[model samples]
Target: MTAPAIRTGRAGPEGGSRRLILDMAARLLRSGGYHQTSLREIAEAVGIRKASLYHHFASKEELVEAVVNDGVRFVDEAVAAALAAAAQAGPRQRLEAAIAAHLAALHGHGDYTSAAIKVFTFGSGPVPESVRLSRRLYEDVWRGLLAELREAGGIAPGRSPEALRLFLLGALNGSIDWYRPERFDIAALSREFAALVAPNGVDAAK
Candidate 1:
């Protein structure tokens, strides 16, 4: 059988096709996890021949790599957009907006976003270094934000910034298992998190 038509250079339609391939790859990988999804599965989902994927990705790993990369960029843009929209807000508000955007970016909005939530095998077997770097860069963005909050006195006095960062990030990451749009609004969750980590506000009430 003739392989499905694919544009190699992504001049126009080929570029669209390339995006389709990436989107399909992200979905399949997000649903089945990286190891479970194969090039054949992705191609089948795209209604293309398995070999046709070669026109886009060199191998399954490459496609998965791209998915993770897309996920990183997706979250990065979200946080940046949140910060941009709140340029005039105080550090506390900016931090809250960033937290909300972070959760929104991870709320299974799409395969790329979902992939960021579920894919965590970086710096280990099968995961690439580039993926790890991208993930780290995202983490650094959070770190920088938290640093700003600490410097601005939004974080409680004498609180270990490093420890607080770990707790907040871990709490946010854990939402992947339990967070649901129907049950809890992303905005509320963000507000709650921001308050919880904000010095003596949420914790003091507790």
Candidate 2:
């Protein structure tokens, strides 16, 4: 099933009150973490009354569920689109395409993606089941991609698909903290990472 599209642009007044609230919520959640963010803060950020937030989301958890899901959906769709574009390409090429797409989406939609990661990673409170499910679904996409690469012998012989997937995603996601657009290009970063993990060990051709 197709997930709802995440608003990638600024949510002006015409963008619908709900979307504007989501945009602000994601930004706050990204900057302040889940616990540090509040419904009143999100409402204020969106220039709406705190009571207005309830009209869209019954509680803070419900609002967070939406933001977290949107975050995963945005990257999942980006990677899916990139893979479809490279459907006829070789496994290595396809992997590179996926990497580039993931990085682009990660940095391009930093607020949503970063908030999702930080909320999931550091939140000490209970997480909604739907939010966990959404994350698992997105991770499955990478698992499938890595499984394909392993089948094609693109991964080292001794490496497990799950291990490689975790490592790759961890490294990629961690870039949100240190990646500098002026210092590095997403395409180059993707190629460099792909080469590092390629079976042949630093195969520029791959």
Candidate 3:
């Protein structure tokens, strides 16, 4: 995939230098992950001195905090829009719409979304309370979506909504590791994932 363009100068049209830095940091973090990424590397990638990077962000953790939050916000907004657009649809369809929106956001905002998932899931060390809270808010969106499906009897009889949320999210987020648009598409992937909640339930491969 092509790298996100970083506008230069003290005030870039792309939300200025701060935005540029975050974009670059997210891309690097997606590839190197949190532990492997550093302020210096982000600075270099953005074509700025480490000292200049410090002007925008005091520390590496601070920079990552911003990127992680942006990541969640991007997906959150996309799913919200999808749900709103599908308001008249049945609970199952609404849920499927949410899944499709989520997949689109994950792949579309590749750097930010993947960085958020990688930092939270694979980064070694304590995850900040701020990061956890941000994630919880995003999770609540899924909780609400799943609750609607449960209330409408759209979910499989034996599945726990909470467990299903985790399972579905795990599959969706885990796609970052192997999902390739060239080989397959997000729309088909969303349908296959949504099938898990179908009344008959989907059979797992033995």
All candidates in order of TM-score, best leading? 3, 2, 1
Evaluate residue 26 in candidate 3 and report its C-alpha lDDT on the 0 to 100 scale: 96
User: Which residue window of length 10 is worst by lDDT in model 2?
Assistant: 6-15
Q: Per-model C-alpha lDDT, please?
A: 0.78, 0.82, 0.84
lDDT value for model 1: 0.78
Which of the predicted structures, 1 or 3, would earn the higher TM-score when compared with the native?
A: 3
TM-score of 1: 0.85
Candidate 3 per-residue lDDT over residues 71-156, each given as its tens digit: 98889899999999988887777888999998898888558988899888855788888888988999999999888877777776
Cα lDDT tens digits, model 2, 1-206, are 57455443444424477877888999999888888898889889888789977877988888998998899888889899999998887778888899999888777855787778878875688878888887888889888887887777778888877888888999998887899888889999998888877746322333
Ranked by lDDT, the better of candidates 2 and 3 is: 3
Cα-based RMSD of candidate 2: 5.1
lDDT of 1 by residue, 16-112 (tens): 8778888888888766776677888888988889998897788877877888899889988989999999877877778789989888888856669
Q: Who is ahead in TM-score, 2 or 3?
A: 3
Which candidate do you rate higher for TM-score, 1 or 2?
2
